[model samples]
Target: MTAEVQSVDIASPIDVISEPVILTYFETLNAGDFQATADLFAESGVLRPPFDEELVGREAIAQYLAAEAKGMKFQPLMATYGVLETGDTEFTITGKVQTALFGVNVAWNFVLNPDSQILSVQIKLLAGLEELLNLKPGQDKKKE
Candidate 1:
């Protein structure tokens, strides 16, 4: 009689996801703290879009943050857009993240890792971001 080995996969996509993951750079990113944003990545993390250049490791993220930080005017407006888990190690976040880049709003789709670190961030710079600096997606800051 021969013995065979079997493989098992008990972890579903949700197993690796850290839902309600902490993102502590919202206000800092708006404040042009690129270094701060860069610090949020894991030491070996990667940030890339579907058709964009891949940013790998901490230094790369720091460089990218430096450029973005240089273009800041004031605090950015951001919120929790949506969360989707594709696999055990893959997660997606679609949020209304705004900045003064091109004086427009930036709706970002931030693909992240299990540790709440950034893997990718795609921004849809809105047409009139300057006009809505005080708004946070569903809420209007002007009403205050």
Candidate 2:
């Protein structure tokens, strides 16, 4: 007998994301199209992931995501928009990221240039130190 695979449908948070470029970033990243995700950024865009050195430029961003973000899904829940003193468009999205082994809440702060291309994305984990320390490498958790 063959085992049937089941697919879970997670609601798209595109409506909550007001910025077009930011919407595309989540869409492409969730689709596991690393290169496409990277292409949303400007030529000198930066990705600042938690606990790591910033990945600078599209090539580095694509390569890093390809290596680390496979099987990861981002579910954005809320967004706050603003403008920096430098006049760049900025926004922060709070969401949960589901990985094969576990899920964690995260906030992504995006900075966009005048042309709507990504200037930088800074990701911060919302988990407490105790919560983060409790996660086991191979433990599977139900998607919340």
Candidate 3:
């Protein structure tokens, strides 16, 4: 299966993502420090990944990322922040995730606690149904 290259307007200036913890999370993740990334979250924080079971707590998030996100890098393009109805702070970020296998657009919605720790991060893939269906296992590797 072949992946399509979509045109993204990267010429526009990226909006500032003001949360220090969010910034640190991405930095640690890109640096392959999964434990440090997980530490930025609350003790009972939740990580809801696309098409996977929700992982709750720092330990679970750390383990899951260590196994799944080894060579992944996140390039954040833009962000928006607001308050949820439940009084929690919500921050949404749009970015492209680059892996050893492929690159995909994604959105991460974060709910933060009063202490500014991440309470939950819900990840969603920004792809159409056809694009998603076209993805195949080991597609990025050459057949020996």
Query: How accurate locally, in lDDT, is each candidate?
Result: 0.49, 0.86, 0.82
Candidate 1 per-residue lDDT, tens place, 79-140, comes to 33343444213323233333443333344445566566766665554545456555445353
Q: How big is the positional error of residue 68 in model 2, measured in Å on the Cα after superposition?
A: 0.4
Question: Which segments of model 1 are wrong by more than 4 Å?
Answer: 1-23, 48-52, 71-102, 127-144
Candidate 2 residue lDDT tens string, 6-110? 222335677778688988999999999999999999999999999889999999999999999999999888887776667688788888998887888999988
- How many clashes show up in model 3? 0
TM-score of each: 0.49, 0.85, 0.81
lDDT of 1 at 100: 41
Q: Give the TM-score of candidate 1.
A: 0.49
Mark the 10 consecutive residues where model 1 has the least summed lDDT.
Answer: 1-10
Candidate 1: pairs in clash: 30-76, 105-129
* Residue 137 C-alpha lDDT in model 3: 60
Q: Which whole-number lDDT from 0 to 100 does residue 103 have in model 2? A: 84
